[model samples]
Target chain A: MKELYSLSAHELQKMIAVGEVDPATLLDAIFDRIGSLDKKVRAFALADKTKANDRLKRASEKKLGRLYGIPILVKDNICVKDEATTCASKILAGFRPTYDATVIRKLEDEGAVLIGKANMDEFAFGSSCETSCYGPTRNPWDLERIPGGSSGGSVAAVAADETIAALGSDTGGSIRQPASLCGVVGLKPTYGRVSRYGLIAFASSLDQIGPITKDVRDAALILNVIAGYDEMDSTSVDVPVPDYTKSLTNDVKGLRIGVPKEYFIKGLDKDIENSVKKAIDVFKKLGAKVSEVSLPHTEYAVSTYYIIAPAEASSNLARFDGVGYGFRAKESADLIDMYLKTRSEGFGDEAKRRILLGTYCLSSGYYDAYYLKALKVRTKIKEDFDKAFKDCDCIVTPTSPTAAFKIGERMDDPLSMYLSDVYTIPANMAGIPAISVPCGFTANGLPIGLQILAKAFDEGAIFRAAYAFEQNTDFHLRKPKL
Target chain B: MESIDSKTVRHVALLSRLSLSDKELEAQSRQLTSILSYISKLNEINTDAVSPTSHPLTSLKNVFRKDDLKPSLSTDDALKNAPAREGDFFRVPQVIEGK
Candidate 1:
């Protein structure tokens, strides 16, 4: 057999379950893969080889849980007891959590070995990985391009074989966009479907922790492990968790998919359009009906998301003042100087930009004009999706406008950066489940992702539809030569 | 309809607690103005009677549990690695003064 690192998470788990392979051997292979590729990709922030070995030893003793020694990478934003959870920001450079996040506890209970914390854009603000206090994560496909972000490290790590699967928090396309750019699968579960007890907040309402993996089956497996209600999180849903893997069978005979006309408009790249259209054709081939649907509020998604996400972000990040947690200025002339200098130095440019925009929108004089108005528009966006769901089991769109661009291409243009999320933001705003699956590559060899969104708590529909598409296409089977 | 100027940029920076330099303010002022103008397209849509939603799901009730004091992080453990720390507390410059 090939190196264990070369296999998908599902393949590894199945082999281990049948006693064809041992956890020790797989753990060593994972360590070796991380040692080789992580320096170039800058995938992980903190790794404890000793702890990983301990977990493997337990697995060998037959004391292992469901995941049983599968090497997993966690986004730096999620808290793991006794490990640094920096969120890739200087503000929390050495901060460590005393208690594990609820998801971490659940994963540990399943005997999944956490290999390390992956890097991300500081405070989960940037769409590209470039804004991390540590550094940018490079795409495995093309070293010169980005793996979409702020979950870029998690996405890049899986693509580069540093880990078979990883956890990422999605707010405004963070998980799905990076997965699209990196040519992997990223799932953003419905809001409140997973516990937010340990995730450092970026935008509480929009954020949900989900999985990014090499394949759809692996995403389903990870979702089953993490999705549940938790007493620790006030926003957690009380719904019963379903066996996500059970829905992966290629049986979408009567599923109806809606392709929004607004998403195929002029700004979308022709290559991406073709790739998604081809994916729809694949769905049609697999006994599903694909029809054109109108979502008129699509144009307002980017504008509304920018306003609403940041408005909430501005409030959530208020806890990071110099007085409480995170960074404080070295020497301050006065209280005001301390606050100014600490925040000025603590946050990256993107974080500051959002904070300012959010603060502007939420200011007393502007609240009724900007923030409140944006919320009303947000309702319309959700209503549009609610209306569309009446005719379709799931909605389909291009995960992003184009494949990964050159490193510095959109970094300097804030509006252009915002435009990158045009396709995926509405799903977050609507609190629906969405998955980004590889569809095809562009003429330039960059991968395109087909995004599938389902109604609230209907991740089963998303998995069934995505699995159907994955089964009908060869895109998910392709791997980066590197 | 809106063009953000240096004054608005300064005000926003103050609100966000960022100490932007004059150079940054000059550049960001133009950038913010363009973004705000682009988003002002919302002004064209008449939404007089529609109620704004703060959360996506309106059915969510207050999901809080009773505040119980579990084991707190020891003061030493909490402040051990702080960049700037004082005895049993995080030392910061005074934040407010008496009127």
Candidate 2:
């Protein structure tokens, strides 16, 4: 018998609709699975069964919304009113948000039960989950290897069947890269397709909340619920929310797919390179019109992102001072002393490093040289996508240059870690939508991700391509030995 | 040609309102030096003709809501997460040199 916990959100929804499965029994199975495998995978910062049960009881009494009675894990950075929403950093320790993030509100309004708080990089600062205060979330495929992050815990949870689906925030590959490494479906929607009202701000401009799920259809299902305009977020676009499931039909025939030649470079792992190339061939076989394209400015994505993301992060993070919420240093002699001491003690090394770097970029005389110059380069990056998208319905590339590395391998090397985001950052830069799907696995069994990039608010195209590719392959069906 | 030395790092840390120990400052100086050096590569691209993009969607403008009072968060809920609270306010260390 297929384990109840191993089923997808759609499957669970159907079973419950037919009265073949009880919602409470499903929750019990989910928590039971998490109870056993989480010690090895370490996917959550907090998995409160008590609170989930309370939510389950309440949800049972509600009318059916799209995701009725299905369990979902939310990234710690997204606020769940009256529940701990720490961003896996000590600074926000003991902080429970006073209100729900719009996405959280949307999910629960659809009868989706919030199961747990997923672990992440401290303040979403690092590429590896190692930077989180709760320690690293290991990849289910190989516990010794790292799960690509800062959404590592969310992705690992979904990959390990810890939950039916999860919500994660992507600020330059936090969602896609980790999804790639964990061999699951992750999508970063067009910049404003989803509201960012209650998500803890990282780099306000680059950060977006997206779904990390077991397959592309689930991604579409979650996006259907969460993607829409809200009065709360100014950045959210006033676009019509399409029934994304309608785009899930496996038909890529005559679709224009762009293959960026720049992504095939020396540093990309041979296995990943081959797997992505193979994914392209699969697309061609399915009648996708594939041809070489150039995103010439791609070389500058990481450097440009470092300048812009940090500058905004430094500004956004200024809110974490001791006065209002979260950790506060009590012994300080005065206000300024308290601010400095509280921040110094509460933040981890990576968070401190990013704060310093961001401050330096936007600081005094260096602003024009670093910050302004980066913004100009960002225009070029956006233009590259614009010119390429003119002829292509979507673009394809490896989500990361390499697969999951050892946990501590790049922790000491921040630059190397930053470069891993090279392929995934461009979508955020252009405010375009992108998805990462299971393309193949490495020789040692770590999965590789095939990323698809579609134009702004054209997430329907991404869903189409990703769903088609997923249907034509069995990579997503392979489970970890755990 | 700019490099991040300890003095520069300390100044930046101060600006960031973070108090770093000497060891952390030294390590930060080294790491920031390398990171900033890497970021400087943007200079290679001739972006003189391009306009800077602060946000990707240039179409979005100012967003406003109706000028009516809604049922906002109750003071108790607002102060619920405050590390130090006094009655309806968040209490903090004295500012502006007390009288």
Candidate 3:
């Protein structure tokens, strides 16, 4: 029965279909796992055991969907009808959503069971899960250390076997970074690859919701279910949703992988660098060609990201000012007082700081100087990637500079925290698909991830490359000894 | 590089509708100043004659669904989750007459 926890969602469904295992029994085993493990890790804000059981009952009565009876967790930022979609903010602390997010609707249509809302950085602001209102999520590998955020809860849940897989939003590396920290496979699909209809805004221009799972195949399977056109989101692309799972195979012969010279520069941990290099050598052994490439505007990614992301965040967050919905102060003498008091008491410190910086950047006087300049620099950075993609099938680099650090190690210094996201942020900015898979582990045994980035809407290439890597390496199979 | 100060931080906070205490203002002022200074390194790069980009893809076509009415959440369902509400409306504080 304990081995049931090790089965992938796809494998479990197949077992259920063959009548080798019962869905309700498997669901009970999953619930038992969650009940036992979730207390220490603090992954979910709410787990709907009753609702999941009821859904399982209904599933037993009828023909099941592709992912029938597969239990999944979603980031708090994604809306689910009648569930708390707080985005892990005090302002929206007890607010239940009125409708399911597009992704949730799709998940329901496909018969995937939503177990709970995972914790996250309040309003998805911080890179470390420490900023969550509930409490920090501990990495399953080492309880004292941090799980990366704002999707830390989702990643941690999947890593700790609390759930089979999860949906996470990536705004400047949220999904991939946490996935890296927690030893899970995470994908940040192209900006418009997945519909953003129900995701709470956090740097809207950069936000994308993708899957975090234990393997590349599972990630691709979830992406296939969730990726599609949605009328609710204006930015959603109307392109056809290809069968991402079907595209995954261990075939990368003659594929060109670009190794960016800038990413290999100083500041990369020697262990992480060596691990990624070894992973690339495995690709070479699998019949793929690797070449050094240049993204000349590499250094500017962090700077440009800060400006654009904040500027857009400032504008999008304007809606949360104690007006439309969410938290409100009780003793306000007037409207302005109400607005001031509610927001001040509601938002966390990091969120407050970002709103100020973003507001300043978008202010009339500084708009051209900061926001506009960052935008222009961002164009150059995208152009660099565009040029490089012409020469390579995908770009490969260390997902994070090093393995997950202790929770408070870099939080005091925001700049250092921001630098941790350098390798992954460029994909969000350029609107390309990317994934982070376990490449190796640090000497202390924390997992390191290697990122694979593909051209816009070319998730096929990413799936193919990641599957190829997983096939040649045992890194993805090593679970933390939690 | 842009200079940051306590007064500037206060002004920005007000504009952003966030009421911070004097102590928070002081701390945030210092923090924002440092972050701004670090990010100001972009000033050294010469991005002359480059166009600003808002989205990664160049095609600016707006993908829209038809204006057909689909079932939206009921008003009761929508307001069921509201922290504060009045009859048929979300209960926010008065803004117009006082202003």
Candidate 4:
């Protein structure tokens, strides 16, 4: 029999609803699994043993919501009432949010148990989870390697079956890259599909929240609960949300799939290239029409993303001046000194580097030359996607250039670290929905991800294609040997 | 492309309100120079006719809410996370020269 923790959220929900297992039993099995394996994974920033029990007690007496009694992990950047939402940064240490993020509220309403807060790159600033103050989350596939990050801990936990599913925010490739490396299903909804009311700001414009799960159907199920508009977030769209699970059809016959030529270029690993191409062939055999499409501005995506993300980050992070909340520096003689001391003492190296880059880009003399020019290039990048979508229903690419690299390998090399996000950042730039599903594995057994992107609010199209690809392959069924 | 030096890094760090040591400044200057050089590739593309898009979505407008009363956090909950607090206000280093 499959272990309780190994079951997907949908499977657990059905089991609980049919009275085969009680909420307490499921919770106990998960906590027990965490007790056994979390020491190797280090996937959570904070795990609350008491909270899930309280939720279980309440769930037993009621006809639970759609995610009835299922345990789920949330990325630390998202707020959960009375829980420490540190975003894996020491600056926000011991800070407990007084209210829940919109997604957390939605999860509660759907009867999902809040199991723990997963670790992340500090303030969602780095590609690898190494920048996290809590330390890096190791890849379950090989403990020597990193789980690709900022949502590294969330994806790692789900891949190891430590949780049924998780919620993570993607500002560039935080969700998809890590999900790809960790061998799980991760999705980044259209920019405005999910509300960002209480998600800690990284780059306001590119940030979005989505799910990481064992398979694509669970991703669709979680999206059904979290993807919608909320009045509190001004950027959230008012479009009516469809039941995403209905999009999980195995027959993707006659669908148009666009394989972008830009993503399969130099520096892509041969193994990853082969796996993604093989996955595309499966789509073709399923009666889907495949064609090559060009996203001409693709090379500029990393440059444009770095400029816009950090520029916005510099402005948004100015709120952490050691006044209203969080860490405060001691021995400051005046307010200005306090601001300087507090921020310098609190943030990590990568954070400071990006902040400086942002300050320089937005400075008076360089604003037009750097920030403004990048924005115009961003327009071209988005237009590239727009024109490409005119010819294809969905675009496919490898989620990362390579599988998870050894920790500390690119720690000192910032540009090489930035290049890892090359294939995944354009979707965020275009404000479109995209997903990463396990396509195949490397010879050493590290997972490779196949990314599928659709036009805005066309998550159903992404789901249909991803589901069809997943059902025909055994990649999603393979578990990491722990 | 212009090279980032220690002096420039100091200026940028001051603007960002981050204090750094000399060693940090030197190291960061080297890294930033390389990163900036890489990003300079964007300048090669002609964006003369392109209007800068600050946001991806084109349809966003100013969202307004009615001025109706709503339940909000209590003063205790609001100040719960503050590192330093006095009564109902946040306590911080004095801004003015003297009282």
lDDT of 2 by residue, A30-63 (tens): 9999999999999999999989999988877888
Better of 2 and 3 by DockQ: 2
Each prediction's TM-score versus the true structure: 0.96, 0.99, 0.97, 0.99
TM-score of 1: 0.96
Interface RMSD of 1: 1.8
Candidates 3 and 4: which is better by lDDT?
Answer: 4
Fraction of true contacts kept, per model? 0.57, 0.93, 0.66, 0.90
Expressed as tens digits, the lDDT of each residue in A173-253 for candidate 4 is 999999999999999999999999999998999999999999999999999999898998999999999998888889899
Off by over 4 Å in 4: A61-63
Candidate 2 wrongly placed segments (more than 4 Å): none
1 or 4: which has the higher lDDT?
Answer: 4
Report the lDDT tens digits of candidate 4 across residue range B8-98: 8998999999999988888899999999999999979988999999987898878899999999889999999999999999998888996
Q: Please tell me which model should have the higher lDDT, number 2 or number 3.
A: 2
What DockQ does each prediction reach against the true complex?
0.60, 0.88, 0.69, 0.87
Q: How well is candidate 4 docked (DockQ)?
A: 0.87
Residue A262 in candidate 1, Cα distance off native in Å: 0.9
Q: Positional deviation of A469 in candidate 4, in angstroms?
A: 0.5
Q: Candidate 1: list runs displaced more than 4 Å.
A: A58-62, B66-74, B77-81, B95-99
